[model samples]
Target: MAREGVTMPATNQHNEQASATPNPFPEPALEYGENPARFLVEELSVDDGEGTSGELMLARIRGLETIELCGFWLAVERALANKESREPRERVERAIRERKAELEEHGEGLAQTEMTPADRRAVAAERDAESVAVLVDEGGEEVSWSRQSGAAVGASR
Candidate 1:
């Protein structure tokens, strides 16, 4: 069933390759898959809180690669956040600065009012997982992932 403000196309966004550690979120439209080649996920709608915006979706439009550009920029941001070393962090930050300039000049053309389906799901899952991890760690339990079930299990060190 589709939500009130979201519309997704029917696409198999799941990764077929089985790994030693499986992904906890396996729904195709819910998370980023292991395969980079599988790009098209689903269409989404965008709406303002005041009901003043139009619907926009992930589509291969003519002469418009805004979705791809947005995804690349997001990946760069993620890499910057995940990098711990100063050198790598500095490199990503530099790239981000350069991209920010370009975005400032052309952002209006590529502005998205709603999150992509995969991104929305990933964000929610990440937040939930982070909260759970923090709670577990606070309880003095070493949080570990189970390879067989792909669930986070509390263990004693």
Candidate 2:
């Protein structure tokens, strides 16, 4: 089943294949229990072929956390859709909302990002000003909007 000119590499003691050439993109060392579950962005750049540079970013998530988050979100969706799961769904939703409210109160916002609060606000304001379809509630607070859903989020500090 081996293809012509395609030879399998010899495995080392760790079961990893021994390569003749060193890998440019070596694996990053990560500790699971040391850090909380989160997303990390590693930004790179490439030429756009028009004298402009384009961003190449990596949104890195650890293996276990990825699976756990996917499972949790799926369960939440299923529970919300099923009438029989109303009680459990409500409790879960309430917890999430409360946590979100607490985070907002503490000015943590949601998730970790590299951008400072001021920078984020500036970007949000720029986007809102550029877009004619920006959604604003009756309170008219300046908040960041979701890129995908165009929904207004928590007010900026």
Candidate with top lDDT is 1
Any runs in candidate 1 off by more than 4 Å, and if so which? 1-88, 106-157
Tens-digit lDDT string for candidate 2 (1-157): 2344432332122343243222211211121121111111111246656542312111221122233333343343344345343443343344344554544443443334787556666776897777454455556644345633445544343
**How accurate locally is residue 38 in candidate 1, as Cα lDDT from 0 to 100?**
25
Each model's lDDT: 0.36, 0.36
Give the worst 10-residue stretch by lDDT in candidate 2.
34-43
Candidate 2 matches the true fold with a TM-score of 0.22
How far is 154's C-alpha from truth in model 1 (Å)? 60
lDDT of 1 by residue, 1-157 (tens): 2333332222333344323222222342233223211221211234547532212211322113334444543453344344423232343334445555544555423344576545655776787666343213444554444432333445422
Residue-level error in angstroms, candidate 1, position 116: 27
lDDT of 1: 0.36
TM-score of 1: 0.21
Give me the displacement of residue 13 in model 1, in angstroms. Answer: 12
